[model samples]
Target: MLAPLILRGVNFKSGIVQGPLAGYSCAPFRRLVWQHSQPAFCYTEMLPAKQICIEHGAFNRYTSRHPDEVKLCYQLSGCDPKALAEATAIVAAMGADCIDLNVGCPKAKIRKKRHGSALLAYPELLYECLSAMRSATQLPLLAKIRIDGGSNERHNLLVAQAVMAAGVDALVIHGRHWREDYSVPCSWGQVALFKERCKGIPLILNGGISGPKSLHALLHKTGCAHAMVARGSMGRPDWIHYLSGPLEGELGSLSLKQSVRWLKQHLEDLSQLESCETVRLQARSIVPYYAKQLSVDSAHHLVRIIRGSSDFKNLMLSLKKIL
Candidate 1:
């Protein structure tokens, strides 16, 4: 049997959870992830607390979830504790099975909003915000934070202690500092160290875990109870299944033909998506990520897609040549 994974208070007998990615967790894409049998849980793209609080319709647009999606967690980010609480209450009322407060993203736009990892400097505020949410909702809550460099050990410990004290059911620590770029390798050793400090609460290891070797190694090194996969799952929707078991025998990883076929299916189904441009941008944005794995014909298929000449027939024609 595959590993039965659980994180924070969310349990996944499926052993894997799809990591939330901005611009990727829209309804159509999430549907793809949820359809996979291995990914037992899914998270919405991070929504700002203010937006979730005030923009009910738009929040529903981002968070409208599928019935088949098991243990769906909506991740929210913002600096204000009060607004964060308000947003948590609203989403809990709207039927979020779990809620994750995102403090791990390091994007400039998110930082400018005083959200994501930028709030690390305000551990007190993070505690208050989490505590408020805990008081407001019966749903499970997870706090995600980036591990500051190995240098800020003391600060990281303080932050972790506060989060655990605030009654968060889980702590997801991305083993990288806010200042570090993706080019820098994520240190699983740091995750293990943090896990040691957070012995009682569930600690999930995040960052730089793209393949089986890294995933297994990190799980062993960090002693993490669970792992979250992000960029790894993009075009390879079966990434979670691949992680749960080796694919060298059954399907042996997705072929270039299979990838293109999936993309075509995604786009075809997306025609009925609520917003065409949003769906187009998301579908189109993924081409480059899968470009390298593609065969020659598949690569050109992406080029044509980028050129904005996509239709069901054109896409199928491009894919048929490759198949």
Candidate 2:
């Protein structure tokens, strides 16, 4: 159902996309996504406008893109219009295929900083920030936002209108309110409601969509042009292929042998981008996501090995022993 939709002038090879996850959607993981699912393009982790303005080219984990990530989109957050515009220009020069402004992040820390969903409360400022970003680059621009329930619906629509008026190439609408948690269901009605209001602009539906199949179903339900996969790609990087590629595999999960191989490659990719100390600490957290696809005992075995490993090289050796 997802055709190659054009934004500005870039062609997203697939309408399905690997959306940005704050901590998990780093360069190494996205590189793995590209090798497996190859859905449109993967967005880099959310970047702070002020941070990008200060550390545009430095060796930063959040800013590093894999050399193979040809169609990368940079998602930027901040309330400062100048900082966003400057950040936009910097990423554009850094080879961003498209840029997205994160207006839907619901984390309290992000809101308190007036950077994420907090900006939804001030339409005027968001409009200014977006307009400045628009003026910065001819490259495609987008804004991602969340829906608020009941009394706040009108204001939510206003924020959508504001970003559109500011010249975002498209909009990504999350079906839940900023105050709501993921445990709350993603309201397809809310996503459809935004589609009704912003009739002409291209919209990318986010939230609760795990991969291409559900994404296709959501598009039919909401009339959105495309969809973004978030939590669905955790551990199962090969998810999109089940929907559009070979159906021989059940439920899009890789085999345990394949999983171990991919996991090894993931760690190897991280080795080039981050130091051994960073990889060792991060591996403890990353294993659980991969563990999700494994049987309960296998998952536990993987986790224990990663957690008990004394060092980074030990971590790899332990993973190799799993097979």
Candidate 3:
């Protein structure tokens, strides 16, 4: 069995964490996860450090955490040291359990700003940014970085060493380069190599962990301290509970009716917490996942209904009909 992770004195009961998914890991989505699945830790969507530093209410949306989220880690991304430090302090003041620097987002827009995985190419700058954030607050600092800018193991190792040397509490490494497509297999061997190189700091393996079986296998294979679940758990909020095993009965025994009830509750919660525009977008994005559980014709019809409806009430009604 994998032991619980202890990062800078905070104890996480499970080794699994919900990785930050930009638009999807917002307040309402997190609330659903906490209420249903109960992952060891959860992260806010990546908020830009520069925006937090410049805009008055920029952190407002990200910081609207539920009371149940005791282990929330607010993730920030930026290339500027000063902005990062300011944002770290702001997040700490907002009662975040930990602060995570996002250096592994592979989006082209993020890379263009020299943020996210772009930092992997600039070791010295990444170290400086980490150091500045470390000095800004006493909160536990975590960094999420890619394996390398390219496929080179040596380069990945050097970056991992530098991240540790800069005083981060834990490291989350995605096992592929930023430029690589998701079709390429994640380098679990490279993740194992990182574990070998960075001995003491807790290494949380991100990417390629789709479900409980893969999570356990990766942990065993890499000797990683923790795993972060990403796209796998998007619409299926119960994934964490399923992985935790204690709630296996709930997942295993859920009938289609029960699943539909759960999906309805999730949609209702999102409607109450977010604006109509957000609800519409979320419905479009998440409904397809739930549709997969239904027959192909029904699923297609349901998606079309969800996509076409602008009103939340009509969308919910149409969804209920399908269920």
Give the per-residue lDDT of model 1 (tens digit) for 126-235.
88888888888877788888886755444687788778878887777777888787668886666655666777776767778666666777777655657777777777
lDDT: worst 10-residue window of model 3: 246-255
Per-residue lDDT tens digits for candidate 2, residues 21-88, read 99888888887887877687788889999989898746567878888775888999999999999999
lDDT of the structure predicted as candidate 3: 0.78
TM-score of candidate 2 on Cα atoms, chains taken together: 0.93
Model 2 clash pairs?
none
Distance (Å) between predicted and true CA of 2, model 3? Answer: 1.9
Q: Look at candidate 1 and give me any clashing residue pairs.
A: none
* Candidate 1 vs candidate 3, TM-score winner: 3
lDDT, candidates in the order shown: 0.72, 0.80, 0.78
Task: List model 3 lDDT by residue over 255-317, tens digit each.
Answer: 455546656776776666678677777787787766776677766776788788878888778
The candidate maximizing lDDT is 2
